[model samples]
Target: MKKTLYSLFVFFFFIAGLTNVRSQDISLPAPEKTGGKPLMQALNERQTTRSFTKDDLTLQQISDLLWAGWGVNRPDLKKRTAPSARDFQEISVYVALPGGLYLYDAFANTLKQIHNRNIGALSGTQAFVATAPVNLIYVADLGKLGKKEGDEIKDAELFWSYANTGFIAQNVYLYCASANLGCVIRGLVPKDKLAPEMGLKSNQVIILSQTIGVPQK
Candidate 1:
């Protein structure tokens, strides 16, 4: 009798978990592409910020931020805002929000929920990462580069991926500057620990992490 009751309990727990994940999936509003501080000005103003406030950003801000980083600029060509070497476009942007972790679906203008668990602290080693409103994890899908999942990924193979991530990260930097937000691109990520939490496959390599939030005043 105890065995049967335990099995039923486990079954209900699994179903509830799936329901929570489905509920956490978010459909973002269309990004605001026009009107901001001009290009040169945003560039000049761009700087790394370590201090951040716990205030949450609006859904609109999140939408625009992801779009600026990697949205499809040319729908006809399916091209992105940031350039990719040989157009491999291997980088996938995963957002770590207070509510959960999500992958930025640039084409759909939506954030597909990865899990309904907050992994903000795992996004970086910095103390501020634990409280930042957003953390963007730049992951490289090596499958697009002809490497099979579970295959060993070499540093040489990731040469172009690093450069590609830089472009995307910089795009976010500029967007933060124009929006008067604070952000810092970080290399001090605990990849070994974070990878498992993010459920990353062998082929999906984390390249960098960027934290974004309102500057603490």
Candidate 2:
């Protein structure tokens, strides 16, 4: 009877572990695009300007920006503005706003509030993070890239994560160009502090932050 009880406990434990793994899968929201000036015009006008006007973006504009940055674009669900290694969309954007911090839910096409107010202090000492109308914090989940046979291969996957993040950042830059907004991507930040603040896992990495607002006149 003792052996049978032990066996049953182990079997249930294994099943529970699988259930927990399945619950963590994320489904991003559909991408929304608005008609605007051509891509070339936006690219030509694209400029990284750190100085920004103290103006907040409307919900529609915010939606468009996120869509352009990394939101899903196709009905087939295959392509995005940014390229992901092995089609593993490991990058997540955390929006830091005056009201609070929000995680962009791409699949749901909505912003889920992560905090009630500004928590830019956790990002860095820079005043820009706090003052900008919106700050996009890009994070990459290394584990999402999948397991490899060796440490070197794992490191390579991490590099791919960073590369893919740049793709998303550039997409945002171009989107800002079309919208005539000011933006800048910065890499200087305390990563260790940000990960926990953002509620990320141990294998996740904070790639960079982009501050966006109206251009200071």
Candidate 3:
């Protein structure tokens, strides 16, 4: 009986260590730059329109969009085009494609597949969300922010979260302009229901979403 108990304890301890390592491995890397059009041109022509063609974005285009949105632009990773409150860097982008749902691994510059096949139905009340070739879902992890007391801190955090999201949205618009794609920043979805569908933790909040596709001519 003593031997069995000792072995069981060792096994559980090993399992616990493995779980911790796995979680750490899954943390996102800082974004990397993908050489594309000049920022000046992308910014000059950027515009938001809801009308999109029923065509998908290529992997390259998706990559560039993610990079522009929040990918690291410098070696130190201290600077990003999008500002995060207190360097919490809590914002995460979930890419919804006809093929399936994926989380953008900015550091890896790769799309990590989450679900197999289209789950566009998850974006409620927005038929465009279902039809657009790609939908970018911006989720903010509140746990990353330092704990605080009072509504003042909470309100400040909320504002910063939305502001960070806008930075990403504008990046997408610029990418669309440069690539001749159609895009729109949407805030119409029911985030409460959408959050569970994306398999997010209680601390993760969906702040905004956008649709990207070829323009209907």
Candidate 4:
């Protein structure tokens, strides 16, 4: 009986250790909603960069970036920084960092811990993706559009979702430009390999991914 108890204790600790390694909710600093380059200059500087350094982003920067991408500006109606068709606001932003994959809750302005693995490498097909500090995977949660469980997701139904994600991605691009960071919006994600890693449901369709980091000088 003592031996059995010892085995159980060890197993419990092992599970706990693994759990600690796999999940962490980062409560980001409040975003600075003001003070950047003029809108025209940000537009002019918006561009893609495929090279990056592995330097992690600061908490403030992460907060601001996520806010720019899709944070809710109007809480009364729950409207986001980016608009959606019929205001469904169905796009879900999954952030893959060195710690793990997180879901950005724009209204709450928090990064909820999802999977604990460093799945940032799976965000894009390009080699540079593995080294980038941040990978934002935009997923269309069709369930938000009244999709029942196990409802089929047709490609035709995703047109509006694609448009919604584009607005969010462009916001990220402009934010990167204004902040003097580097980013690239990409569609070359290995969705098959990534869905499992991200712990996504069948109703969650991967739309696009955008990688960001300190530009390699």
Which candidate number would show the highest TM-score if scored against the true structure?
Answer: 1
* Model 1: CA > 4 A from native: 1-22
Q: Candidate 1, after superposition: displacement of residue 185 in Å?
A: 0.3
TM value for model 2? 0.77
Question: What ranking of all candidate models by TM-score puts the best one first?
Answer: 1, 4, 2, 3
The 0-to-1 C-alpha lDDT of every candidate, in the order given, reads 0.93, 0.78, 0.75, 0.90
Clash count list over all predictions = 0, 4, 2, 1
What would you estimate as the lDDT of candidate 3? Answer: 0.75
Stretches of model 3 off by over 4 angstroms after superposition = 1-41, 146-156
lDDT of 3 at 121: 61
Q: Per-residue CA lDDT of candidate 4, range 30-130, in tens?
A: 89999999999999999999888878999899999999999989889878888889998899999988888899988777899996788988878899999
Best by lDDT: 1
lDDT of 2: 0.78
Clashing pairs in 4: 22-116
C-alpha RMSD by candidate, in order: 5.2, 7.9, 5.9, 4.6
Show model 4 residue runs off by greater than 4 Å.
Answer: 1-23
Error of 3 at 110 (Å): 1.7
- TM-score of each model, paired residue for residue: 0.89, 0.77, 0.76, 0.88
lDDT at position 182, candidate 1 = 87
Model 3 Cα lDDT, one tens digit per residue, 91-186: 889988887778877766667777666767676476767777888889887767754322133445577789889988888888788888878888
Poorest stretch of ten by lDDT in candidate 4: 19-28
